[model samples]
Target: MLTNVATVIWDGLNPFEFGAACEAFGLDRSNDGHENIPVPAFAVCSPTPGAVRTSMGFSIEAPHDLGRVAEADLIVIPAMGHTTPETLPDGVAEVLWAGYDRGARLLTLCSGAFALGAAGLLDGHECTTHWMYTDKLQRLHPEAKVIPEVLYVDAGQIVTSAGTAAGLDASLHIWRQEYGAAVAAQIARRMVVPPLRDGGQAQFIDRAVVEPDTETFGSLLEWIVENLHEELDVPTLARRSLMSPRTFARRFRAETGATPHAWITGQRVLRAEQLLERSDRSVEWIAAETGFGNAATLRHHFTRVRGLSPQAYRKRFAC
Candidate 1:
């Protein structure tokens, strides 16, 4: 349902992230031989609608000023290198605050999340930035829940992406939600990128670390993912890990940052999402397949977690 789209960019912006947003939303691909590609109106706005230098020593012009944000259905903020408290652009925060208040979704690419943090929009939202900047974002916006290594966090009205490539992931995610899986897939094909990558996919914060299963819960998490359809109660998992239930609960939270039940429910919801995307199976069957026991329970949990019912999700994502 996105109509008017705009990017509020700043000086020293990273071109790749800005380009990622542009490629996803700004470009007119009607001539790309794809049918039913919904294109939204696009613009680039800035504090000053003039020459803006990029981090790579080049400049791009912003054709519109901050006033244009008031008409946008979605606003993008691409990375401006490493932004701190002092470097927030003049009058940017006020416009973003106004935009969010008016129900326009705000999306931040990479360290552009710092701009949202500056605007106080990230307060109490589970947002993220480039992994290298996660700690700093949390420190600066202490009220924000900054997760370090996820591709992006979609906080309903605000979506924040991590790292460089994660911006593309976020962009495609928005497409999938607003359009449908099929349309987003066609767009991805046009762009020669993967069709879809769920936002929960991990960001490559650093090279993988090899650690013992006892410390990292690496083996346990793998097993949990594989056996999501089975009864994954705490006692059963505790026995599998050769620890008391209390110790297992503490360890599970320490390693995964979610309680055992919550993590398992999240995994089940992901499994449900995959099933919804690939098949026309009945919700009752999918619920049992994903260990939700019945359609009503599945509906309850899926609606709570995904903000849509199983049927609605299938309508949006099923091919």
Candidate 2:
């Protein structure tokens, strides 16, 4: 059903976000002898239908008017380097709502979700934006469930992404739904980016996993990392931290933003990714080493967080 894609451009646009949507759909990949790749009809439209200024102090001509966007099968709103959309065409919100009403898929990259939020499209839906402005987005539209620190959120028809290249991940996710995994993988290979980065990945992985607050629980957290191969249940951790289970759980969530089990699982999966890339060990060995204990358990968690099983990830990413 995704046939035509229309992207809305405006002044103060971030070229990277704008181009992510354009590159995903606009290019005629099938014409390049890639017969399996289906190219959707793509066009760039503007509120004013003329010179659109960019964040880099330059301008690009937008040839089409926004009038046609309401009929598009997919509508894109890229980040404008700000949360609030400014100087949009007349009835832009209405146009978006019309598309939604008719069953068109709407995607917003980074701060572009703000536009949908203004239109009340995000109400009662779990959506996301760039991590830096997630709090502000939540404040502006209190009814929308804004998930922060993840790559993207797919609330059925409405897809929202984090900053920069996360847009490609969201676009590929949509393509994977419309087309097949083979087609999505081919496009990802052509684009020279990793295919199938899951939406739930930590937006800031290293900091979110490795570098927790050092002032409190410094040595305790370090011990957990060192002993990822050992049992890391809450009771064990609570005993080690010298606090009761309930108090430890509350304190852990207060400081780390994730429960102890969730935090420990993320670290183990991170280690599993590294081992899968750098070492030639078997999946069972890696699983045991990362404290998952068995292949099935490791596969379940790894695929949930990474969107690729350990064996598949090794095939694609192993060096």
**Candidate 1 lDDT tens digits, 64-93:** 999988999999999986666578888898
Candidate 2 regions off by >4 Å? 83-89, 198-319
Alpha-carbon shift of residue 169 in model 1 (angstroms): 1.2
Clash pairs detected, candidate 2:
none
TM-score of each: 0.73, 0.66
Clashes of 1: 0
Off by over 4 Å in 1: 198-203, 208-281, 285-305, 314-319
| Clashes per candidate, residues 3 or more apart or on different chains | 0, 0
Q: Taking the tens digit of each residue's C-alpha lDDT, what string does model 2 give over 1-319?
A: 5689999888888888898998899888877668867778888888788899999999988898888897699999999755444544467788898899999999999889888987789999999887778889999889999988678888888999887788998998787556545566678988999665422435264354343455777798779889999999999999988899999988787666578888889878878877887789999999999999999999999999767899987886664
Q: What lDDT does each candidate get?
A: 0.84, 0.82
Worst 10 residues of 2 by lDDT: 197-206
